[model samples]
Target: MLIAFFTNNYKPFVGGVPIAIENTARMLRRRGHRVLIFAPDYDGDVQDEPDVFRVLSIKNFNNTPFSLPLPLTLRPAYDLDTLSQVDVVHVHHPFLLGMSGLQLARAYNLPVVFTYHTQYEKYIHYLPFPQQMTAELAIRLSTRFANSCDAVIAPSSDIRKTLIERGVQVPVHVLPTGVDLQKFRGGQKDFLRKKFNLSAETQIVLTVSRLAKEKNISFLIRAFVRLCTYNSQAVFVLVGRGDAEDDLKALARDLGIANRVYFAGELVGKELVSAYKGADVFVFASTTETQGLVVLESMACGVPPVVVDAPGVRDFVHPGVNGFMVPEDGEADFAERVLTLLDDEALRKALGAEALKTARRWSLRQTTSKLERIYKSLSAKGQPRGKRERFIMLRELISYQFEKLLEEVDKLF
Candidate 1:
């Protein structure tokens, strides 16, 4: 099958959404599908590849926090030209690029699939508008964007539920964003520790993510400070870059734990794998993830996680099994859980072993196979039966018409 994978960002730009697109494209290609990625071109020259296609020249929107690409124009000509050759179009976000993909899919009469990766509602606080009004507008836009697809994929049940609540009428599948198991599996812990300048006696707790506002890195800093109050030998390592770099540094100093914390910005490949393997525990406080890919990677490296019990994250970490899940804002509770893992070597080993086992369920191969099944299902359904027919059918599905009709006899109550 010819599949057009669309995204607002691509390689050299690191984030969960781009990683998902890359992994999906690679896996689908390996399975004998021709996958072409359609994305906006950044200032730097993107390598030309047989399957990768760049359609627009975009500019960097913000210099701080992170670099976001804003397209020079909203014209659909580029997308229509590239998407005309594909059997299916899979869009990876609800941004300008995704809208273009939706338009092209409509024009070509192709099946469209969408993966809802980010919670734009939570991100509204970062914008200049009133938070509630902005969130509402985002919800309306997201609903329309998702409804344009033949089916919508949600990385976690939490996200699926949110979409349904916002009146999305499409079929939603809970597919996890995956990890590279071989690269992250068991390895030389001592070598990694030494490479990071840590002695065997030091306890390492790590967090790998972009330092954005939604990540709530300040909470991690506070929790680390509390951890250090008891265990002075514990070290905190942060991997990844963002606008909050200096703010996080200043927070560490204010908390009086600057000496014990280290920020290793955006380590990838073997270095990133080593960082995961060497850590005794993984800590993440972010409430903005659609699915925290780093959590699974850490688990694959045999490192247990201490995460907040929030959307996207709840799908990965199971309390008392592989990791601990604390309340979203509970810094003390989070620190206490970390301390428990730090204090008990036997418990850590047991949990880490189980975590490795759990990580196997979310392999990239499995995710790709599930996606293939969805593609075949949509294809078998055939071209949509006109706009009105499609809209009525979608409304019936959303209204639970069959179930409602069956229960109508008992509605007097």
Candidate 2:
């Protein structure tokens, strides 16, 4: 089987979507399937890789301070020809590249699948208009995009429910991104501790995510300040960098927890695994994740998370079993739960054990099998019905035009 993945962002750009595309494509290739990635070129930093296609792209709208990659189009002559040869199309995002993926599927008479990766409404602040206006626009556009796809992959059942609630007519599949358990099983924490100059008796609390507003890092810092009052020996280490780094650092200093907080800026490979293993507890307050891959990574390393009760991470936390899931508004509760895990050694070990057991169910090997089955199922369905396909193509065209109008209006406002 030949699979073509369409993503707005790729390698060298830090985010969950790129990682998902890379991991799935890698595993699919190992499973004897030909895989290709169609992504936007960012600052000439991306290198030529086997089966990967990078198109010349530019960043227009200064939407966010993160310098996000916003591609112009995917209709280049060569790209069209390359896309025409694919057996299946899997799109990671549902706005720009997503519209292109749907159009390509129509042109090639192939099945197009979309993975609903982010909660669009939660990110409307990037636009200039009032969030309410942009949020309504986001939901309408998202629903139309999902409806046009042959199938929509929701990383969690909660997201699937949201799609159904928003009137998505297509089939929604619950398939979260997978974690490589083997990578975490053997990673030693001592090396990381020594490198960071942490004392053997000090406790570590970690949150691995892009330092962005939607990630709710500010809320976590405030909660960490409260947590420090209970346990001064604990260190809060934030992994990954983004536009919010300076503000987060300043906030930590203002809160007088700067000495207790460590910004360990994006550790990959064994170092990342070691950071997870060395931590006594993983802490997260992001309520906007489609699927919290870092939560599974933390659990895979036997460091259970005390996360806010959000859709994706909610699927992983089973309270007293694996980890605790605090409610969205429960900042105090979130801090208390982290303190609870920190104060009790036996309880932390028990929860961590359960977390590892739960992590096995989401191993990359098992999730890849599920993805393969989805691919085969789409292949088996063959091209979409002729009349229905034409209607879908027409609807998508109109929807794309309408979305562009909305975007223009947003810019004007």
Best-performing candidate as measured by TM-score: 2
Q: How many residue pairs clash in each candidate?
A: 1, 0
Looking at model 1, how many pairs of residues clash? 1
Candidate 2 per-residue lDDT, tens place, 295-319, comes to 9999998887899998988787899
Predicted structure 1: lDDT: 0.80
Name the lDDT value of residue 28 in candidate 2. Answer: 86
Can you tell me which runs of candidate 2 are displaced by over 4 Å?
60-79, 128-130, 381-413
* lDDT, candidate 1, 277-378, per-residue tens: 888999999888889888998998888999998887898789999999999879999999999999999999999998988898888888889999998877
Which one is best on lDDT?
Answer: 2
